[model samples]
Target: MAEHKDYYALEMKIDQMIDELQGLCSQNGLSNTAAEEVVVTSVFLYKFLSDKYMHNIEKFAEEIGESVDEVLANENDELDAFYDAYPTDVVFHSTDTIQALINKSGQPGFAAMFDDTLERISNYQENDKFKVSTAGGEKEPLFTRITENIIDKSKRDAFAVAIFGIISESKFDFSDAFGGNFDFYSTIFEYLIKNYNVASGTYAEYFTPQSVSSIISKILVGMSQVDDNKLYDVLDCAAGSGSLVLHLANELGHGKFGNRARVYAQDVSTKSTRFLRLNMMLNGLTESLDNIVQGDSLTSPSQYNVNHDPSSGYKKFDYITINPPFKMDFSATRDEIESNWQDTDRFFAGVPKIPKKKKESMAIYLLFIQNVLWALKDNGRAAIVCPTGFLTAQSRIEKKIRQRLIDENWLKGVVSMPSNIFANTGTNVSVLFIDKTKGDDDKVILIDASKLGEKRKEGKNQRTVLRDNEINQIIDTFINQKAEDDFSVLVSTKDIKKKNYSFSAGQYFEVKIEYVEMTEDEFNQKLSGYVSDISRLWNEGHQMEAEIKKDLGGLIYERK
Candidate 1:
């Protein structure tokens, strides 16, 4: 109970900080735009890093029987040696400390000083791994000159000052929260990006809800037989903000196992990559920061080794999770992918053809599905979020993919999620699980959880939120392969092939017909009532037909 109260207090403080920062943006005329999001998130991150740096120093001081003030008073060489010995995830210089910045807040050119400090910290040599790399071989640092976004140079100073004031007043201490579970940090991450994740452009950013992420992680990890002593690699090809992959890491015993899993993620959105980096740091997965690549996973997958004698392109992973963009206008790169990737066999199921109209409606998720299949090892496991329509698709790339899964006996199971599960879009979705270790005789578990969540109004849309018990129920059923009447079914690959490779649970469920016993006298009475009603209806129809004929015959035709 005390732990819950402490977490609630931290949540309130974080929420207050975000609200104040956004309000400051409004006062400075940078509200509800890309600039506002960048400035607010960056400033918030600066404060977090500052607090975390101080927390580390405090802990180190206690371990060595030294005061924090003594450590802060150390010269450049002494401080560098201390950091080298301690080996913290983030490095902070004496001049880059928040106290130094606070002392200089009243000085002239304070805004420039602030921007310079953030830039220096981002460009520090020790922090090189934190930089996100693009497909063009360019690295993006953590922070930019965010104050420049304010058009009025005069207000820039006030803007920076107000941001510092808000952060200092709130005094965020993430020390206790870091020891908390994934739910604690996930809540903060979601709240941080809720406003920016709404509808954007052709590439709409779909942040997978926590319920869906939890279900995927729980089932994927629960069903797999993992070795506690071994280190594993996990990937999320279309990781938006890293929620799915983070949950999977936690399930794999992240903190307890001491970096037991290395998380590799790639996404096409720069904004999402930034958010993903923050999430990794917040969750104590700092070792995986170098694996976070910001590029088009389809056109140029950067998570491969090219330095070996024979380049091992598209590194295979032990586990994979994906929530790819359902549809996008990849028409620009469709031809490039076809011409370049033919030898790789990455798109074994083939790509969606460009339509004459509405090219944006092309099903790009098919490519992601095929990519996941190619990236998995012989005994690997994966879970993918797909449109519900993909389950029952009878032809084209969708059917071909399902056919491959069934023919190879790699399909594990599928769960149909509730409608409006994602508050941003109303399209229903399903999770497709794959396990390469399954044999031909293994039956697939199909669950229809579409009717399990409660409906609630979220902003302008109605969202279906799954309760804790409902999520647990779905996970338990899938992991144990339990077949419930009308809700779930366990089917063999032979039966799946007979059904034209459809993965929908409803198709496999039995259509039960109830029979009742009755006496001969009761049956006769029921038959007589049915015959009388039919006879009366037939007589009424004949009378109506005669009346219609007479009315038509009495009418006279006239031309005007």
Candidate 2:
């Protein structure tokens, strides 16, 4: 599999390149290390795109209805020269104007060259006919926020030279490395996010541990029947770096959905959108890049409206998934959401109460849950990562959401996962599966997987790592609606209602109590032993008290 490729080598090379870039940035007085990383990585992406273009020259030419050599002859002479001497340290000359500016090798020159090069490669203004769609998007260029002043001109040349050397001679061919499988790229991106070579954020915003994504993806795909002719629209309303959506796309897209499964990703973070689009490109899912939107998913969802109507907006999606921000202070936008989307169907459960102070703990997940319900088409299934408390909380909104899921019969099941499943947060989480199609089905599968993970510490925070077998077991039990003792149970909606709409597996699972039987003689012997031990301790306590008194008597009193 492509995932087993020598990704370590690529990681090592990228690390080495980043070290050089950072060293140059530090020397050049670039205080904003985060911006430096972003700009440099953006340049690296462009280099990869350019290199991929060169390596696949024949294919690209054919797609554009041109002869390969003819197309190559018309390409930028400097890029062509650099490609010719690639994989070697041979010095190459470039006739391109950007190269001329860089040759000046000063602050202004480097900035000018950097700006021109990025625009030429990404914006494709230099040659409109030959454009890499990755960079020519309607949204602002991914690195538009990167200003030329980020690094000094002298440092810019060093950065440029280091980046050029790394890209030109590197053995990593992203296309060949990816080999049509995105998992390897996804892992590499995760590694980058960890190393802080990508956007700056809490790691949780960029990564959903593969174990979690794996479980969600497997369960979601297993529960849904894929139709080869149907285009499954997979959405991650809070798609942090696009891990969940990409996993779903890779897993479900290959089966009956084929390439027909389009991905819709939205995140409120601009940095997240950048990482997400790069993830999609790395996975060769650049076709769906446009669907990755940057905006507040709650108040201003940029994709198809969650509240879709026949007369106006796009159709509802076939599948929806999200691991939304567990808690956020949406007080700023609360008025807008409440005033505009007052329909009970939107925030059907109830809006989280606006706390006057310290509103960061507001239960945004409830609203996301409602959004998922609205976004999904009839018969659609959604697997959402939620705080485990949501399943059992007596809070008004929390209970209302659970009750509605039960009464409306939208909930398929709830898997109570172990605490620290997410390394970034300690909140115990659960994967709530809601199937609109299964509304008529009374049984709701509740699995207590809270104890199923291998307990381990990840840095300061603890996490539960679910093995492949355990993941599969959870999926199987839920999909087959199998009720096992102490592990999972299939409870009817009636039973759930009786339990006050509590989806907690513990609430329904029968607790078994075991007792050991003993004869009269055995009980008497055990009782006697306990009595003797207690008597001995009593005597010892008296003797210790006497010894303390004697020791005090030995001390001389110094009276003032």
Candidate 3:
């Protein structure tokens, strides 16, 4: 009970921090814009990292039998020795502390002092792994000059002071949240980015629902024993806000295994990459922050060039989960991908042809699916969220992709999700699970969970949310390969090929027929009643036809 209360209080405090930061952005006329998102999230992250650093410091102080103040007052040599003995991921200098900044809040150029402190902390030599890389081979630091976003230079100092005041007064201690569960951080992350993740015009953040993320994570990690000695690599190419990858990490025993799995993520949106970085730090997956790339996953996959030569091809992973953009204007790079990498076998199924019109409607997810197939190790598995229609596509690229999956014997199973599963878009989606080690004779599990989930209004959109038991049912059936009536089916690759490589569960469901026995007298009585009703209807129709003719005759035709 006390634990629950503490969790609730911590959640409220975090919410207040987000709200205050957003309010500060609004006060400076930066509300609801790209700059606002960057400012609010950055400041929030700054405070989080600061508190996390302080938490470590307090722990170190306790170990040394000294108060936090005394530990800070130590000479440089003593402090250096202490840090050497007890290593930490985030290192902060004495002047970078929030209390240090609070002391100088009333001084001139406070905003510069604030920005300088954050910059120093981010650029710390030991914290190099916290940086994210761009496609152009440039590494982006963890913190930038956030106060510069304010157009009015006069208000920057006050804005920075207000931010300091919020952090200093709140005194957030995230020590308890270090090993927190997925639900705790997932909720906070979603709420933090809710205002910025909405679909606008063409570009969208494509945030995956927590329920869908859970289903994918559970099904992907099904029945597999976690090897403590083995290091797993998980990738989500279109990882918006890192929900899918984070959930998969939690499933792979993030708290227990503890960095046993390295998460690699790539996305074109810088906003999403920033949020993804924050999410990694918040979830105690700071070791994977360096793997987060802010670039086009389809065009230039930077994860491939992390520690290996680009000529050696992409890095294979133990597990991959992605919810790629369903459609986008990838025409700019479509031809480049086709011409440059045709022989690389990255797009083994072939890329979608660029349409003369509506280039934005090009199916970009097709390329992501093929990339996933290529990046999977021989025994590795993956789960992808794709348009439900892709499963039953009769011809073209979609059918070819399905055919290849079946032909290669890598197709494991598919789960067709309920309608409105995502609150942002109403597109019906299905999860495609791929396992390269599946034998030719292994049966593929297909689940039609479209009937599950209750409807609820999320903002202006109505979405379907799966209940805990329903999600469990889906997972249990898939893992056990249970063929429930009308809900799930287990079919072989040969059967799938015979049906034109369709992965829809409904296609494989048996069409049942019912029969009922009746006595001869009863049949005759039922037939007689049907004939009497038909005769009465026929007589009424004739009378009505005659009346219509009379009425038509009364209406005279007039020429104009």
Candidate 4:
């Protein structure tokens, strides 16, 4: 629990490594930032595997039926050539091997090496000696994305040297950081997405900030803990890079939860889906890699099935967490969804109308909400991130959704967060908690945390950052259903309905009227000012009347 010194140091080294590669690519003919990102992330993975192998090389050697020296000296190199070609100590020894390979075969050769390395790493199976998981097999290997058309010798060499230097850095030690329960690799994955350009396709995988994810994860896990023996099936329909689900997995029980609880995630981005598999493997939930699927969660609801009953076709989960895409074009598949799911109640609130222009801002989050509601089990609970306007907006869909929550008694609480909680977008967001297990509790807890974040500059934009204590406070207040002045309020469902299905805490918060007792001297001073003003007005009126009388007397002769 102490400061993650080594973790932060490792992250810095990776950043330095990225900068080194960027510099090299600039000097070379290659300037594609996307390619550089892939190279940097791939290098990190290589180093991660190298460290794992180095930790247990003797065991690995015994399993391969080779001596340590022979294994160290590139023995029968059929599988994992990178591991065979370079010994544990010499893998990152120098860029000599890589440079030689590049000289012999050029950029295509280097790209192939990366492709093979990544493929081996992803497909590597779990063994008793080393319980490791692979990440790149579900999609086209990352190396294939790089081609000779865009790469040349100088670019290849620069990437190789930069990666070798980074892996060789003295500060990059996983033993120290991974000694405890700290997740160093997951942090590294976050850094990869944070610093680099993973925004290539039609829909970029935007990760939810750790602060927000932590709060939602903690609350959902905490609420779901009411019955630990009951296996809780958790799902995130729109699991971007799988950060939200990973955090939930970490909070729930790590590998322990992997056995009893089933984690499901679906994303439309193939690239992000692969990234998600890597994230799960890195977190020690090697079993969870298969649970993550690649496809549009809305249209392809195959994995959303809870009991795995094709007869029901629709699934339910004990717990769900999602930060779905804000605005996306589901128009191509919208009608099909409407027609098929019309009777399913998933779109009972009403589907968003596809606009003629700028179809990007369509209300995709609403569909996700309805899906969560349908997928949630009878006693299930869900934590979802949505636009703040969704809470109080009088739109037909928004109102109907709110009304359903209140009427069905599934509404738990709404935490109104500050603007810019998500650094990439300016739209303010809130976490809507739903619990279907309510025992006739008509009151819904609403916590206005809009003023709770610490203001900080993240790049060119300002973001509201919430510390752990603040996040815990929000959860605590909601769990205990406390109504603190100006911070949280517990409102009845009838009142919420009366207010036109508004779930905003600020609207229901009691306005305190404070009366200040006036001292005798202060009262006299105020009265004295009023008296002086009245006297001045009376004198002015008399002076004007006298002036008019004098003017009339003087003008009488002239009028005659």
Which regions of candidate 2 are displaced past 4 Å?
Answer: 1-32, 58-68, 74-111, 125-138, 145-151, 170-172, 196-202, 255-258, 305-314, 455-459, 515-560
Candidate 1, residues 243-271, lDDT tens digits: the string is 99999998888445587789999999888
**Candidates 1 and 3 compared by TM-score, better number:** 1
lDDT against the true structure, per candidate, is: 0.85, 0.70, 0.84, 0.69
Error of 4 at 11 (Å): 4.1
Clashes of each: 0, 1, 0, 2
Please name the candidate that would achieve the greatest TM-score relative to the true structure: 1
Single out the weakest 10-residue window by summed lDDT for candidate 1: 305-314
Judged by lDDT against the true structure, how good is candidate 1? 0.85
Per-residue lDDT of model 3, residues 1-560, tens digit only: 11366777888888888898888788889988888988888877777776766777788789878888888888586578666864536777778877678999999999999888888887888778888888887888888998988888999999899888777745675667666666888888888888988657322355788888988998888846668778798999989888999999988874354676799999998878888988888887877887888899787888876664366556888999999989888888889999878878888778888899999899999999999998888889999999999999875788889988988888889999999988766789999999887765568999999999999876677889999899999999998899999999999988998998889999999999997799999999999999999999999999999999887777754321
- In order of appearance, the predictions have TM-scores of 0.94, 0.80, 0.93, 0.78
The per-prediction CA RMSD against the true structure, in angstroms, equals 2.7, 6.4, 2.7, 7.2
Candidate 4 has its poorest 10 consecutive residues by lDDT at 126-135
Scored by lDDT, model 4 comes in at 0.69
Look at candidate 1 and give me any clashing residue pairs: none
Clashing residue pairs found in predicted model 2: 107-153
> Model 1 misses residue 375 by how many Å?
0.3
lDDT of 4 by residue, 165-271 (tens): 55563545454444534255555677666654235431124588777777787777766554445455789988877778778767776343334456787777765
Residue 265's lDDT within candidate 1 is: 91
